[model samples]
Target: MDFSSKLLENAVYEMSQLPGIGKRTALRLVLHLLKQPEERTNLLSEALTDLRAKVNFCKSCHNISDTEICEICSNHKRDKSLVCVVEDIRDVMAIESTSQYNGLYHVLGGKISPMEGIGPQDLSIVSLVNRVKEGEVKELIFALSSTMEGDTTNFYIYKQLEGLDVTTSTIARGIAVGDELEYADEVTLGRSILNRIPFENSIKAS
Candidate 1:
């Protein structure tokens, strides 16, 4: 696309770099931002800048946070012994919306996708194993999506926790095959969490 102003072009280009945003959508967004008051645009820019510079990952679960630990991890009422394993903060948010689980969470960062060059080491699996070894976590709920990579990551972590006292479970198939947890309806997701089965049973069924 051609632009009369290079500033507009630059803004659209940067905005288009976001996932699911095309050049056309980015251009429209840039134009909308340009139409807004200068203070509003400045606020947007300042918010993005602050998000990138000031955000911290929770030391315990690796969820994005403003402090060293996320509110969920620090919440005394949450079940610390029941840790839900998820891909990232989005999934954490998805599960939290269900309000069916009172457990803590462990964000793996991503699944083990060989096609994408993401492996066990690329995720926060080691820290998870350490958490399990520390004997605080009594059960691990594998809440990753039902994709092959997700299953692989879950099994890899399951093996790492082999012979350990912690029990392992996976969310029920209320979520369709290959579906992401973030996309599932709150009711279905809640039911899945409530009806989670043993990791070994999931392996046998697979």
Candidate 2:
């Protein structure tokens, strides 16, 4: 695509770098922003800058936060003993929307995908194991997507917690195989969480 202005070209290029956004879509977005008031564009730029500069990850669960700990982790009413394991903040938001779980969460950052060069060490598995070993978490709910990498990550974590007192479970197959939790409907995700089964049973079925 040719551009008359380098500023517009740069804006579209940056916008296109976001996932699922193409150059055409990015160009449209940049044009729209250009049409908006200067103050509105400044606000958008400021928000993005602040997000990148000031955002923090929850010390406990690693969810994006403004403080050291996220509101969910700091909430006293949440079930600290029941920790839901997920890929990232998006999955956390998806599960939270269901309102079916009162448990805390542990964001693994990502699943173990050899094709993507993402291994067990690339995630927060060690911190999770430490949380289990500390004896505060009584049960772990594997809430990763229903993909091979998700299953592999779950199994790896399960093995790490071997002989530990904590119980392990995985969301039910209500979520289709290879489906991401973030894309599932709230009702289905809620039911899956409510009907989670033992990790050992899932392993056997696989």
Candidate 3:
């Protein structure tokens, strides 16, 4: 698209570089910012600058944080022996929203994607093994997504932890309750069947 100013074009280009953002959306954002007071844009820019300048990764879990250790890792009430391994901080947020897990987390930073040139060495896998070797950890909950890369990463980590005294498990994949089975994908429907509980156990909550 043509722009009256090179500066506007540059801003649109930079914004469009963000994931899921297209050129049209980026141009709309740029135009919207231009319509606002200069102070508003300055605040937005300053916040981004401060974030990029000061954001830190949690030393223990590798999640994004403002401190060396994130709040989750520092919490005393969380079960340190039961660690949930996830792909990224976004997964941590998604799990935390459920408030069902009270265990600590080990963020892998990213999954093993051969096509993308990301492998076990590219992630924080060694630190996780070290954490398990400390002898306090008893179980590991694999909470990574059910994608091919996610599975490859989980299997790699599992192999690394072999004979290491920790019990490893994957988060169950299945269809959501109340959803129509006809709409469910074949894999999910098949998994739900394979992982089904006994009728008596399923009614325990009632």
Candidate 4:
């Protein structure tokens, strides 16, 4: 019969629950944490404990924030007429890092994945539609991932915004197919944004 303490077993189990972490990695982490000073372990515990307590979603954009509205949404320097709709907060960080865009952001929180049981209702789509309906935005940029799920989500958003005065478009297809915006480099992402194409507009033989 195994005699491992329940606390240690619980720690390993919780760590293993994180994506990409397995039993072996969790055990290694637990062992490493055990070797750390009490202060280190305490710090980790306190940070995790305070994560949900300190972080709040921005009411306007659904981005993680400490205040009611995220700094990006509140900033007057940002271009209020343009809203970049992305899959998550990570994409916001990626775009911000480029220092090329001056527009506001709307984090959808996730893509529409029917198989995964995630749909527009599961995301911040309603808030996004409401924000656009306010009529301040002149352009809507779809900065979602290039995957099938991302495409599905973008199309859903497009249909929702149909007939709005706002012009809709997406970042150029320069980004590799299936490559997530967060994992893409700054130059590629910046160029992709700079070279965005208009939605429903086509260049045909004159």
Q: What is the lDDT of candidate 2?
A: 0.92
Q: Which ten residues in a row have the lowest lDDT in candidate 4?
A: 197-206
1-206 in candidate 1: lDDT tens per residue?
A: 87999888888999999999999999999888878889998998899999988889999999999889999999999999999999999999999998889999999999999999998889999999999999999999999987788888989999899889999988766888799989999978997888887899879876
Rank candidates, lDDT, best first. 3, 2, 1, 4
lDDT of 4 by residue, 27-61 (tens): 89988999989899999989988996787999999
lDDT at 94 for candidate 1? Answer: 95
Instruction: Show model 3 residue runs off by greater than 4 Å.
Output: 200-206
TM-score of 4: 0.82
Candidate achieving higher lDDT, 1 or 4: 1
How many backbone clashes are present in model 2?
Answer: 0
C-alpha RMSD values across all candidates: 7.1, 7.2, 1.5, 7.2
Error of 3 at 161 (Å): 0.5
lDDT of 4 at 11: 88
Candidate-wise lDDT, in order: 0.91, 0.92, 0.92, 0.89
Task: Give TM-scores for every candidate, taking all chains together and pairing residue i with residue i.
Answer: 0.83, 0.83, 0.94, 0.82
Which digits, one per residue and each the tens of the lDDT, describe model 2 over residues 1-206? Answer: 98999988898999999999999999999888878889998998899999999989999999999889899999999999999999999999999998889999999999999999998889999999998999999999999987788889999999999999999988766788789989999978897898888999879876
Supply every candidate's count of residue pairs whose N, Cα or C atoms clash at under 3 angstroms: 0, 0, 0, 0
The 10-residue segment of model 1 with minimum total lDDT is: 169-178
Model 4 C-alpha RMSD vs. true structure (Å) is: 7.2
- Which pairs of residues have clashing backbones in candidate 3? none
- Cα lDDT of candidate 1 equals 0.91
